[model samples]
Target: MQNPAAATSASEFAELPATASHGPLRIEYRWVNETACDAPIAVFLHEGLGSISMWRDWPQALCERLGMRGLVYSRPGYGLSTPRPHDVKWPVDFMTAQARDILPALLDALDIDLPERRSMWLIGHSDGGSITLLYAALHPDALAGAVAIAPHVFVEDISVESIAQTKQLYETTDLRAKLGRYHADVDSAFYGWNDIWLNPAFRDWTITSELAPIRVPLLAVQGHDDNYGTMAQIDTIADCVPHAELVKLDGCGHSPHRDAPQALNEAIAAFVSKQK
Candidate 1:
């Protein structure tokens, strides 16, 4: 792996054309350790309410430590990317749509050949983590490994309750102002995620059965004190994927990357190194 002291460049944007399922969108992305193109590539997927900027320097820091190239991007409705249409309400299978449609489209636009090049991995957090699992399961041959932090395999009552509280906070607190710094259209980004997760019909969401198809190594990380989800999230991954590994961190919440960057980085680096 490469040392974290290596030089890197600033973040940039790329325009992805419209696909049958998704409209044209601009993606804000950053390349870490660009000089090390020959090394493996790791894609960082942000959480339900996260954006590329919200990840701060962690993605670059982790990529530099692993001596690998990293791709960190905000999904269509987040960060500097395009906003979701006002009339559109995200479907129940929103994450599935991301994994099966948007993600592949974004990668194709970026010219990342997954089928021909197998040295790629996905590091996703929260909703992003679930997307990673779905993608990895659907395209088992395209990736080498995956790391999911605070991912939900099934919706829990706590998850819905916490989301409800967040909705209240967004309305009552400065949370909207704080989130505006990260998203281009805060309402689009927030409602697209919040509405679906808290939807009455979405409470039945579960991806455990879909996980059985994953063939690559997986590292599932969760915080013991996570208010949004419990250890059962990663436990489900381990139960479905025989080669899956779990890391439970204490004194941490839903966002492990933010709550425990040092430990999370080390765990991810070690896991990727072992896979290599």
Candidate 2:
């Protein structure tokens, strides 16, 4: 296996000479260099504990296959981006901060203002899927379409139980040590997300009501054997968005890109191509 740190390099990006904001919390982003194409720019959102580096070669492969520009970046506390602040756990309004605040701010900071000139196509996984739904709902007109893998729309008993199990693994296993390889500060990313989700107040978390407002064409997908969430998660998305398409992959697991790459790629490519 390759060293995770050795995998960190700007050349991996379609656009080099990385552009970033070194503000209170440094955020790095890149815009593909080629002239804009017909397909919406594919913005890959990582999973709950994932960062851009953790995505490995998946985004690059997807962009090439779909013939679209790719935008992949670390959230506030993941990858090589700035660490989360020292004083706080994830706020109750964390999703809002990601959708209403961080995303738009990143776009503005990058000067990607005109959605009509070049719209976006969101491909999100896990918690990133939730954030995508929230964004599409709040900014319905901004995207051409969206695809979410193993998305969670509401807190479920299964989800809470799974997360509790993850907490135990974090404490007793090498999970934390492994996570340290991907994040600049493991605690910033881990605790910020873990502590909040496991908090009692978060049991009532639900984005289904907020997601109903999204008018874009949505493709909700899930693995048959996903360890983290249930099929009901993506099912809820399709139910809410009448036009949403649902695809269930057999013999697959939590990480579709990892467990079912061929199927995931074909589905996304088809959805994005048809949107043109």
Top lDDT hit: 1
Query: How well does candidate 2 score on lDDT at residue 253?
Result: 90
Candidate 1: stretches off by over 4 Å: 1-7, 115-117
lDDT of 2: 0.78
Q: Mind giving the per-residue lDDT tens digits that candidate 1 earns over 116-187?
A: 337788999999999999999998888988999999899999999999999999999999999999998999
Q: How far is candidate 2 from the true structure (C-alpha RMSD, Å)?
A: 5.7
How accurate locally is residue 21 in candidate 2, as Cα lDDT from 0 to 100? 27
Residue 56 Cα positional deviation in candidate 2, in Å, after optimal superposition: 0.5
Q: Considering only N, C-alpha and C atoms within 3 Å, which residue pairs clash in candidate 1? A: 2-67
TM-score of 2: 0.88
* lDDT digits (tens) for residues 1-276 of candidate 2: 011132124623212222342234467554442333344577888888999878888887887788776778888878777678867778776876688777776666555666531377888999888888888898888887888888888888877788889889988999999999988888888888888888999988888778788888889889999878888998888788989998899999989999999999998888877877
| lDDT for each candidate structure | 0.87, 0.78
Query: Cα RMSDs of all predictions?
Result: 2.9, 5.7
